[model samples]
Target: MKKILTAGAFMTAFFASSAALAACETDVKKDDITAEQATELYECIKEKMREGYGSADAPFSKEYQAWKVTATAPAAPGAHGKRFLITYANETAHGEYVKFSEERADNPMPVGSILAKESFGVTKKGAVKAGPLFVMEKVAKGSADEFGNWVYSAVQPKGKVMKIKQGFCHGCHAAFEDQDALGYPVEEVRLKP
Candidate 1:
């Protein structure tokens, strides 16, 4: 009886720990989640996303974390499938991108500028799932005129390059013509220059 009871206790502990490791969930609704809660969810899953994206051997996927963050926390505005998004700008882009300007005149992202946006979704039950890493790279003028000279691509959460249609991404970006085809983060979360 003593041995049986010990075995049962071990099994109980094992299952409990496993449950804790299975998923990072929240009690709040997805839209109702606060910056603090979003941050907590980010901290819980950042490493997993990094590892998954890093496996692709892409510079943007592996090096984005070292870039300057554009927002204080992940934000949502019904874009990117309504997933929460956090953006990072590489050295070539940080100076100009940080301006967060709204006018396109005299405010184009420079060639070589690369912006990487990391995304994640919260299920109805608030179970956090890592999403893809979307990348936008600016090239020389006329290099990609139809898409504002910006090349769009993505890496799946598991490190596979996603099939991207330039027009598909540019179609939505075109709405932000005044902003040079850029979508700034929600005002409240943007880091001040």
Candidate 2:
């Protein structure tokens, strides 16, 4: 019995370390920071975060009541995959959302608009497990190098950044220049009032 228990413990430790090392394995950008490192930075901040980027505490849960889904087909025919649900902070986005359609990609949002996007994985059982929350808030001006003035950050359910490719986010959002990088399906946006 003792021998079996010792071997089990050893196996568990080895696998845990292997997983940690593998977590940092990924392509790096010019900055030399791997997706793992960036995710680590994100997770670290999320762990201690008390508020959204430009908003008060618990913006999604407390402040925003409903989330507007922006996927081409939120109910995709798959057991597991990626999907997006979005929400806006101010009335400007809501106004645009109320009348916007996927065909109308020219709806521009004003500054000071905050968008909270919930990104999660779908289980093979069609259940929702813990996932990341992506937050983007439009600012007065963006750095010359960024996609737009909108600041982007992602946080996991436990509060950490999920690993992703460099420019993995803005690269897609860039297509919506007229909409200030809100690449969601316009027709999918919704709010109570």
Candidate 3:
């Protein structure tokens, strides 16, 4: 009788732990976009990039929101996958902004050369042969700077199997040092909004 009771308890515990793990693997959905709109959201980013450099007058304000896209993985081993984050400003500003970030299993900051050649298949001459898809997770809130703006945070991709990429920081800074060059300033980009 005691052996039967112990076995029952162990089974219950095992099932409970398995259930928790399964819950952690949540599937990201496409409906998270505000306005349930796509084209209008993408246009917002196009306008901001054209404006050149981020400023108070920038078309997009520092608000928290998320956009979604469909993306693909690379074929070669050790090649980091790419994704795009499309974000929008809330009440503080308007328009959309598009940014590219990546995820890898081993090296976090892979060289741009490897990224261009292996992952993107882009030639050193700056020709893009293939493009990948990505989805925005959502802007994080409660973080702010001295200006009292709502800071934004985004996940590179959406879905259950996504892993955070590494080359995002190095790649963007190297390519667009003037505009998407700088990351959110640490003093202004924390969880203390």
- Highest lDDT scorer: 1
What's the CA error at residue 31 for candidate 3, in Å? 7.0
Identify the candidate with maximal TM-score: 1
How far is each candidate from the true structure, as Cα RMSD in Å?
Answer: 4.6, 12.9, 19.0
Give the alpha carbon lDDT tens digit for every residue of 10-126 in model 3: 899899877644432223222332222222233333333322222223112211222221112112222233312222222212211212322212212211101111112222332
Q: In candidate 2, which residue pairs clash?
A: 43-160, 43-161
Counting only residues 3 or more apart in sequence or on different chains, how many pairs clash (N, Cα, C under 3 Å) in candidate 3? 8
lDDT of 1 by residue, 1-193 (tens): 4554588899998997666565478878988989988888887799898899989866578888789899999987789999999999999988888788888756788899999999999988778999999999999998998999999999999999898899999999989998779998999899887
TM-score of each: 0.87, 0.49, 0.22
By TM-score, highest first, what's the ranking?
1, 2, 3
Q: Model 1: residues >4 Å from true position, as ranges? A: 1-23, 57-59
lDDT of each residue in 69-183, candidate 2, tens digit only: 3333222122113432333344445555544445444444566666665433334443333345666666675552375766676565555454654376778778766656665
Alpha-carbon error at 158 in model 1, in Å?
0.7
Better of 2 and 3 by TM-score: 2
